[model samples]
Target: MTELLSLSRAARLAGVTRAEIQKRIRHGEMQTFEGQVAISDLLRVYPSVSLEQSGDFERVEQIKAEAYPRSHDEDTRLPSQQVLITRIKALAEALVQRVARVEALEQLLEEVRARLDEMAADAGDKSGASAAAETQTHTQAQALRDLSAWLQTRRTDLAESAVEAAQTQLLARDSFLRIMSASVKMIPSGHEFFVDGNESILEAAVRSGLRLSYGCASGNCGECKARLVSGEVYRLREHDYVLSEREKQMGYLLTCSHTAVTDLQLEAAEAHSPADLPEQEIQAQIRKLEPQSGGLMLLHVQTPRTNTLRFMAGQRARLRLADGPEQELPIASCPCNGRNLLFTLRQGDDAFSQAVFETVTPRQPVTLTGPYGDFVLADATEPAVFIALGDGIAPIKSLIEHAVSIDSIEAFHLYWSVPAPRMHDHQPWCRALRETLDNFAFTPLVDAACDDLLALLESDLEALPDNRYYIAGPGSAVQAVVSTLLAAGVPQARIASEELD
Candidate 1:
């Protein structure tokens, strides 16, 4: 029997994670003997693998130059065969990029069609098909038809792109043509992982057995927010969060929908305990229901005092309605009052939201579980910045209250973005707080629409650096503002995010 290398050795030799080695094995990209692999087989599978290539193309050139001393007969240092291989690898990368662009275009086109349909329906409802309205409707219908035709055109373009890709056919031996991955450096612990061309940061991290806070893996939940300390990244999917320009400038990102474009440095907010959270469902009751402006409800809930749940401020819990399925919501009350909890949920036609606002009367029986999340305060004296939108203001309140009453902080700033003055219920409270608390500043950002959210935070972003940031909102709203913050270069270590879905 031939001696074979273990999975550990293969991972080490190939400069990849153990999960990556196993994945390649499952795909039959790397051959194995018995349950182990041969060194020759490993090298054959990864001909151009390197130990985190930061400017390594030059290193390869320098190594080649040092091996073959300069000669008078040949001015070109690269051999014809090597040059051809290099060109092929570059072409492969270009093909991958084109495919990605095509996929993004297809998704965008779908969104455009949906939006146009929605606009057409809304317009018809409002205008009652008047002459001018009918003309507009006709134009919209024509645009929709044109869009359908454009989609087909794009499909043809994609086919052409595929044909182009097929011309530069690749072979297993040409592993150098494999797509490149961006290396990510996790601050504080300094652990490193590579985000493959198709892998999002959260996916890569979790796959590699690293623990970070995340929720709903889908774009709807803004749970996987991190700070892109440095380097470029590209969005892989539509994000629900709307980020302010200031937040974009600060470097916040939702790791579930974005992929690293270059060697990166990121900061992650992770759970305090390494072990998985043990969820225990228990009996609870609706203690109070305070109606806020618009379709928002401030629901107060309380579990049995005997079995109090422990969770960080800004953490979330699942609220089970009498006639509805369970809904995940952030606790508006801090952990100081664990058994007695307050929650904020939007009033909607859905069973859960409706139950909270109308059906579920005070003192009604309910089921509750959790105190789950890693959106607690950072252990720093730096100024804290909190941004809350719509019902997302719930968890931010818990954090803000904690900062004022429990923990000692250097300073803190709070920006509340709401649609109208009727929704500005907390203005007087926050203004009074500013007068009483020397370290606190509150800004009421009325009429702050999703697209222009960060405009209110411009001056604050310029003043705050390496300060703790906590954002709570609908996933899309959170993602948008977080992306802006990340683009603004906010260190990921100082940011924490959670979403109410």
Candidate 2:
């Protein structure tokens, strides 16, 4: 039996469109096994199939071709051949016309030379030839002037031809701009214009001096994604083959591919660059490093000089490990604790982890910088749901503690997930939640044994009665969870999620 691959993955591997892949499956050209198609079937029948082997090789080649086809000799040669044939035909016709014109000019020059030689022979036989010599000199001067005039006419024609060529190039450029401008719309909201209409949002924004949230602009990366409140968007190119049907229906546009058809209202949920963030350095002592279940370590750092280090909860800081270089990490603790700074670190016994455990003793000096990330607890009175996975628990933990301290949050729920072993080790944090929080619920998933987290929430969503949801996790996991939540009827406006990377 052949291993199955998703339709999107198969499309990527087969160098065909996802729509094409689906068509093939429907047409019985390829067979779908499980939620994916058999690689063998795709290899056997894909029109552009080059690789006999399976796995990601076919997709890799497709991507390379798309990115750099010019580097391939065969690809370069084909286009060059067509262009060469067209140029050769044009040059051949021009050369033939020039040759015929030159032949006619040569015959006319021969007639003039023959007439001059006859005149010279007549002058040679003259008895008093001074007057004849003067007449011949005048004739020769007249012929030289005629030749100069002819050369000037040819030069004028060449100049005119050069000007016409330049005008053609200018017109071509103008046409390109007009075509591109039609697909792009520029909207000015306040001092800054919100450019949402263009499919190439980043390119448009950058051209206009507006910075957008993007990591890899390629569609596969999902870095430049945005919610389109109202508009029709078309995808040009995508890096990743996966885009859920529900996301499309809900008007969630990947800014990379989304060109605006109608005027749009977009709420960008991305972090401001580090240059925009306030910079500060703080001295703190590592008071305790308690092991938490699920490979999470609860770090309590004491800053006695300052009762509280003013920083954002989801913001990260740099901790100079005792042996290794400084490690930059985000703050996990809620802002409620003034003097004691709390943070959580995911452990794997890596160099940084080893330095924290073996080298850095409690009460050791540590330097922290940040209150970074734009992920913050919104100042809304409405109840919200906080969903977190893996180390993503850090930000949710901060927001929750802050809400409880301010008495601003009336209702909220926290969902945290990690491996079973890590969960077991960090049971105390869960115990603390069970003991302290009255209105909140802490439901931790041992592993990703479940299909969807939002589905689990839907079973009791009505009970919580909160419309807002904040989510953070690894890029892929975050995308899966967000798609699942949106599919479950959560509005795009109500859902806030961030991928740290």
Candidate 3:
């Protein structure tokens, strides 16, 4: 039996009005028994609800001490757009040196040719009396040919070596920081990563093998959300995701969407080693495809039992078919059934997927490489909230099934949102989950209400302050929900997010 609290006590604990509490109940965000609210549920929804939001400077300071970042503003920026400028500068220098050498050699060659002409003319006039001059002219012509061959070789070498490390300093052509002029030094832990104006901080970190939680590598997924503790930063591109006003006040920005302007002293989740999930290159066969309501196809893949893939739930892999380029898609199946894999492919203009959907048939050869992504279930036993947008439901479904199978969780809620009400085709699986699990609930947010996911969530789940939120959606929608959570004062580490294409 779950513990229950009265509406007044719940409101008091959450520091909100009774009407607000009622709204949560009506939206199914709050669970109750005979009209009484669950205390655990209240705590899960309002981790910071007990903290006085009206406190003075000292109180706010105390809260800051307990949280991640110590400050928000007071920072500097980097020299933006250094990569392009660096390349141009390198090319210009190479061209200048090459041109100078070529011009000097041409002048020298012309002088040599003119002297030989004079020697030949003198030899012709003096006949037998100037044999020595004729011999000197032949020697000069031979030397000129040698010099011309040398110049040609040298020019080829210079052009070929122009883009290599010799021209661009020690860093090679593809080096992530090769063109960067500014460096970002993180505070407290002191891990440093370099960034050019063109690359986002997240991209630079990844290239440097420093992991800051990121997904989509676009502005829409707020997974790379971090505070600018004290560095000037500039936007690389306008982000698709919306940020809450509170979040902006807190100096939160997506590492994938911003570049450091100054030598940055930053505050972010410390870069850490990724989990060791053994990776392999395997050949699999396409088994089947089932059409779903959202113009999606449930793709089934099977590999030989001897070469069964090892992957955690909620992880994705890249698939390559025949000779086409590889396409990255999430694994939509549990490891419990290790030999077979499931993935959801949205029908659209993507040539790779369309090729597989329309032309490919069963038993066709496919290649898989991965078990990438760190969006799997956390080690904690906290109740979880899953919000899925469109085909983002794939991984969430994997998580739900696997979590239950592993006894990792029982009670969890899913908010499944689609483009419209007509695309709500996942009710059967949700019903099956409810029947199987001891505690499970699925809520579909479809129709026009699904159009603005942030607004829908803000109006419905604003009271949930503490549950571990696992969100997967288009980058913009994920960012919006994350911004909403951040504005509500949820801890950053508790919000796990990934971006869907």
Candidate 4:
């Protein structure tokens, strides 16, 4: 028999009213295993609920069905939206408080320094009290050290708080702007507005129903790059090393990174269709997990639902592990046999990978939270070439499979490379693809034994009939290929790639 919880107990654990729990249960919206509600159901209804209660748990299938009859979906429930908005607001407010605290601490430090100066001045005037002066000096130095350490800590806190504030603001703003921009009218004669204040213009714009172009949303990818038509944008974080000074001077601002100090009018470089940005979540069972090579694992995930996942070939998903924290891993291969989803995991010596390989098990429930990334083959008309190194072949493989599935027999070539023949264990799949997919050619570049990878890329470019190129691989390899492509006269805009580092 399932251990049952009364409505009151479930409500208390869920941080909701007993009436609400009864209403949901009565409506048959929530599932109870043998008349006992699972703690997990409460969590789905109230994600922010404290995890202090311990017990066996059941999963809730549809909170909205029982809780809010008019709610569109469980994800769209007021509780979930409230959780997101409240958390975002709280984060923003906390950042402001931290900044204020840091400023106050700095002022106190200055005061302490001034007091020490006064003490030093008094000590200088006393000649006969030399011993007392020395003792006082030592005490003052120690005090100064303590104050300095405190100040440093405060500064660090302030820096961290600032980054948090910026990130929260960006997310909120992006969410708002993307929804807004979809329906807004654009003026034929572009209007310029300056971005002023620490408030996120993107968020404001999003809230106002404008969508903006952005990538990584972390300021690392320049996909959100925009020209500051006017006004100054003070960057809150110093991690945007990806953007060059010249780019900044050119008024190029990363919407995710820049806050407007002045009212700013900027144009979005990319526009996405409404259907392209649907929010989706996938539940899957861990079917198989095996070590493919050193530090890399081949993961086969199976979803029970027959709903087709319409994702672009090169797009990536956020994988929420059953045992470990979430990770963003690219779908390394295409969906095979219309049943299994495939991905490659290169175990970087991180806590995430260690948990996945060493601790996570098959039959575990994993959730995927995405279909993000515009690195796919967006235009069917454009003749394209694909390049990948090592496990970077994941996205390329997706694109190829998608292209073949759609009967797009356009001129497509794949150049895939691994360290050696031993690492080419998955090469049989590549050969199979080439054999089945007409108009598709594969070039396998093995290390040391063949012509240099870069040289081969250059030669391939020479023979290509004016086509766009997509490259994905390690940072250095991608850069080398991009440089070669750019030097070989391919337009920068036509050369699309993603650096996962």
Among all candidates shown, the one with the greatest TM-score: 3
Worst 10 residues of 4 by lDDT: 64-73
lDDT of 4 by residue, 1-501 (tens): 123443434553554433355456666777776545765455456555443431211211122112112101113211223233443454566568867987897798778767766665664555555787777866666666666567667766866884444434433433332222211122222322212223244433332223354434455656666776654344544545476788867766667555544224465653344245554577777788988766778887765533323345677777787656788877764432223567788887777687778887898888876677777765433556888777778888776665543332245678877776437656776676565434457897765222365466567665543677888877777887788767766778788887766
The runs of at least 3 residues in candidate 3 whose Cα sits more than 4 Å from the true structure, single-residue gaps closed, are: 1-274, 447-463
Better of 2 and 3 by TM-score: 3
Residues 57-115, model 1: lDDT tens digits: 33322332332222112233222343334445555676698779878977997787677
TM-scores of the models, in the given order? Answer: 0.44, 0.42, 0.44, 0.43
Error of 4 at 132 (Å): 99
lDDT at position 122, candidate 4: 62
Off by over 4 Å in 1: 1-277, 449-458
- What is the per-residue lDDT of model 2 for residues 1-501, given as tens digits with 9 covering 90 to 100? 244555544554454444456556666777776547765565467533433333443443333223211211222211133333433454456558867986787677667666655665554455555787867765665665566556656656855784444433333332222222322232322112222222255444432223355544456556566666644344544557365788767656667555433224554543334354345566778998887555567787776431234454455667765444566666776543324666777666567776775576788877766656667766554666887877777777666655543333445677777755555333455556545444557777766633556567877578433568888878788888877766666778777776865
lDDT agreement with native, every candidate: 0.64, 0.55, 0.64, 0.56
Task: Report how far off residue 58 is in candidate 1 (Å).
Answer: 65
Candidate 3 worst ten-residue window by lDDT? 67-76
Model 3 per-residue lDDT tens digits across residues 89-128: 6556656886798799878966765665565455445535
Residue 59 miss distance in model 2 (angstroms)? 59
Q: Output the TM-score of candidate 3.
A: 0.44
Q: What is the C-alpha RMSD of each candidate to the true structure, in Å?
A: 28.5, 27.1, 29.4, 27.7
